[model samples]
Target: MTNELIQAQFGPRAMDYVRSSVYARGESLGALLARLQRDPIRLALDIATGGGHTALVLSPLAKRVVASDITGPMLRVARDWLAENGAENGLFCQHDAGLMPFPEGTFDVVTCRLAPHHFADVGAFLHSCVRVVRRGGCVAVIDNVTPPEPLAVRFINAFERLRDRSHNFEHSLPDWEAFFSTAGLRIEHRQQFRTPIDFGAYCDRMSVPERTRTRLRVMLLQAPAAARAALNPREVDGRMTFDLGELLIVGRRAAR
Candidate 1:
């Protein structure tokens, strides 16, 4: 998964994105902690620890954590956030999840959340995850996924790309499962997190050009009736409101 775009796009706006963004809201730390059957320890890694939420949430559960990202500025922000959260055990590093510098079988628990869609090579990303996690260790990945239907997937991905140039693709549930399996990980748990992004706020964060923003609004508003119905497009007082969705999925690195 190439991160050139993410590095360029988020490197400068790291702090702003962390302070006010969609990923920071919804899905409490307790929810993620509760999903873990056993405490994570021995070794752990949090890839693309944007805002350091995942590191702060999972730090205490693990003996050690290596939080990494492609952008140095973003990693600095994560470092500060983790320090503020009193998670001194967490360490931040600049690394590409697609081409990590860590050794194989180094981590017992690995996680990447809401960041995969920025990866240009999803399969390569998964393979890297599989490499670092020990056999029978866990790799939990959370990302926005498109609906299985081709049309729905197309529309969702297209809109997201228009909204954020860093956007790559959101794989459906089945595809993600197959992806992990092919990389020697087995699905152990999964959940969907539907986060409604206030339309204007969402548009503002990207600093999307005015014309592009207008295009996005018109495209979403003019979505096919069926798509709109299925999405239950949120509207506030007869106006388009928000649109967002995500999946919190966990997979175990099966012993070969």
Candidate 2:
């Protein structure tokens, strides 16, 4: 989707993300935090900082944190969240992740969480992350991923795109690793997690229409055996639910 379309898609639901337990306190967020704590951070940038949760996590560790997103409404909400949390050093900027305005080697570390699948060009995004971080610095990422099986890949991406129009494509672990390598980032840490998503709430977050919801449910229930295995869809307390595959990886640039 174009940047404008993505902005329009998420602008109205900015607060939903801020209040989302999955975004605010999910295990993936915690894993990113733990990995970051092992390194020293003076200045950090959180790209696509959708509710600014990652930026909030970095504020205490870094002297300054810049939270950026393509969506203005999201930045505003994130700013409020940081301010409410006493993050005096937090700053917000509006920009596309693929075209960051920061100068080369300006930040000690850069992070993007749960947002890359919406990026039109993941490679370009990683290039920006590498360019803005100093040599020896790190670029950490966390996003839902799809399995390598072709049918499973198509099924998962289709499912997500139906749920959120802004969703572009979710890369597999191998795709992400290859992208990191091409961007001159050396993989330092890699871990996976299965995040349970409440089907109803997930659909509501994006305002999926009832008609579309039925389609999604049908896709889940009648998915190919491979897709079903990858998604692990199940009923929880009479509510449909499924596991989202997440990959968290930290790639460090070679020291000069």
Best by lDDT: 2
Off by over 4 Å in 2: none
Q: What does candidate 1 score on TM? A: 0.92
The local lDDT score (0 to 100) that residue 183 gets in candidate 1 is 84
> lDDT of all the models against the reference?
0.79, 0.94
- Cα deviation of 170 in candidate 2 (Å)? 0.5
TM-score of each: 0.92, 0.98
Candidate 2, 1-256: lDDT as tens digits = 6999899999999999999888998898888889999989999999999999999999999999999999999999999999998899998899989999999999999999999999999999999999999999999999998888889899999999988888999989999999999999999999989999999999989999999999999999999988898789899999999989999999999898
Tens digit of lDDT per residue, candidate 1, span 90-188?
Answer: 877888778889899999888888889888888998999989999888888888876678887888888889988888888888888888888877788
lDDT of 2 at 183: 96
Worst 10 residues of 1 by lDDT: 225-234
Report the number of backbone clashes for model 2. Answer: 0
